[model samples]
Target: MSSATAPHRVSDAPSLVVSLENSPEAAAAARDVAGDFLKGLGPPPGRDASDAVVLIVSELVTNAVRHSRTRACTLSLAAGPGTVTVSVADASPRPPCERNPDVRGAGGGFGWPMVRRLAVSTSVETSSQGKTVSAVVAREGGPSV
Candidate 1:
C-alpha cells in the first residue's frame, strides 16, 4: 500500500526569520512579519506592545534600507517565556546614534528614540561586515505599564 502523505501540523506559536532586500518594500514586509508573529503568539498579553512591535519593525527596517550598502536585511522573531525578541540585521557598520533635539530639529533623526521608548531592551552590535539592532519587548507584562 502506498503511504499517505501526512498533513503538516504547525504549532500555534513559532519563530520566524525573513531576509529582506534593502528597499522600501522591506519596511512594509517587516511590519507584516511583526504583525503575523504577534498573531501567532495567540493573543498579545497587551495590545499596545503588539502595536509597538510593528512600528519598531518598520523603523528598523527603514533604517537598514537607508544606511546599509549591502542592500540586504533580516528580520527575526523569537518568543520566549515572557518576552518576544525582534532582531534586525543589516550590512552597515555605522551604528545608529540618538541625535540630540537640536540635531533632530533639523528634521532628520528620531527613529532610535522611538525604538528605545517602545522596547524593554534595545541594543546595537557592530560586526566586521555589518550591524544588528535588536529589541526585546515584554509580551506578558507589556511595556512597563
Candidate 2:
C-alpha cells in the first residue's frame, strides 16, 4: 500500500497524518507509522499504551481496507497530555458494525469489538462521500475491557 506521512509540528505534541492505499498491506503500514510516530515523541506512551495504539491503528485501517470498498484511506493520530486519538477515513459511507466473533478464527469479524474494548471512546461520522471512525485511547493505559 502506498503511504505518506505528513510532517508534524513537535511543539504542539506528536501527531501523524498518513494516506494509505486500499490494500491488505495498509494495516501493517498503519502500525509502522504509529511506531515511528510514537518513537519520535521521545519518552513514548508507555509500553501498554503504545501497543494498544498500534493495535487500534491496525484494526481501523484493516477494517477500512477490507470493508470500505474505497480505493484509499487516511489515518490521523494525535497525542495529547494523557490520551491519543486515532482516526481512519475511508470512501464508504456505511458505518462499522460489531459482529459476533468467529469462533473458528476464520477472520469473518472481530476488529470493531476489540477496538471498543481498547479505546476510551469511539465514534463514527458518515457523509455522502465516506465515513470516518475515530477512537481515543488513554496514554496511561487501562484494562482493555
Candidate 3:
C-alpha cells in the first residue's frame, strides 16, 4: 500500500491518493484509506456515506486488478461540501461492464451494479494508455454508525 494525502491548499479541500499493486489486499487497503480520510475531515461524512465510499472504492479497485492487464492501479479520493469523488485509474483502456450476478454467492459480477446504486453519479474515461472510473457520492448529515 503506497499512499499519499495531498497537502491542504487554501483554495481546495483535502484529498487522498493511493497506489496499489494488483493484488487481493488492494481493496481492503483502499477501504481503510477511505475510512481514515473521511474520519479526518472537519465534519466527517455520515456512516452511510462512508460505507458507500468504501464499498465503491473496493469495487472499482477490484475491477481494475481483476479485469485489466495492469500490474497496479491508483485510487484518488476528494471530498467537498456535500460530496466525495472516488476515482480509480488502471492501465487497461477497456471500459467496465456489469455482468450477471451469481446466485450461489461463490463469485460472480456484482461490483459495478452496486457501485451505480450507491453513487449519485458515475462516469468512465478511457485513453490509449488506460482508463479511469469515477463515482461521486453525496454525504448525508446523519450520525456515523
TM-score of each: 0.82, 0.87, 0.85
| Candidate 2 TM-score, true structure as reference | 0.87
Query: In angstroms, how far off is 55's CA in candidate 1?
Result: 0.7
lDDT of 1: 0.76
lDDT of 3 by residue, 28-137 (tens): 88788778888888788888898899889988988987999788888889998888899999999999987899989987678898888888889999999899999999
Worst 10 residues of 1 by lDDT: 1-10
Off by over 4 Å in 2: 1-13, 143-145
Give lDDT tens digits, candidate 1, residues 1-145.
1112111122335577777777667787678767877887765646877887888888888888887766578787778867788888887889888876456366557888888988898999999978899988888644684
Q: Which parts of model 3 are misplaced by more than 4 Å?
A: 1-13, 141-145
Mark the 10 consecutive residues where model 2 has the least summed lDDT.
3-12
What TM-score does candidate 1 reach? 0.82
Candidate 2, 1-145: lDDT as tens digits: 3434232222333777878887778888888878888887766788888898999999999899888888889889998888889999998999999888898988667789888888899999999989999999888784442
The Cα error of candidate 3 at residue 106, in Å, is 4.1
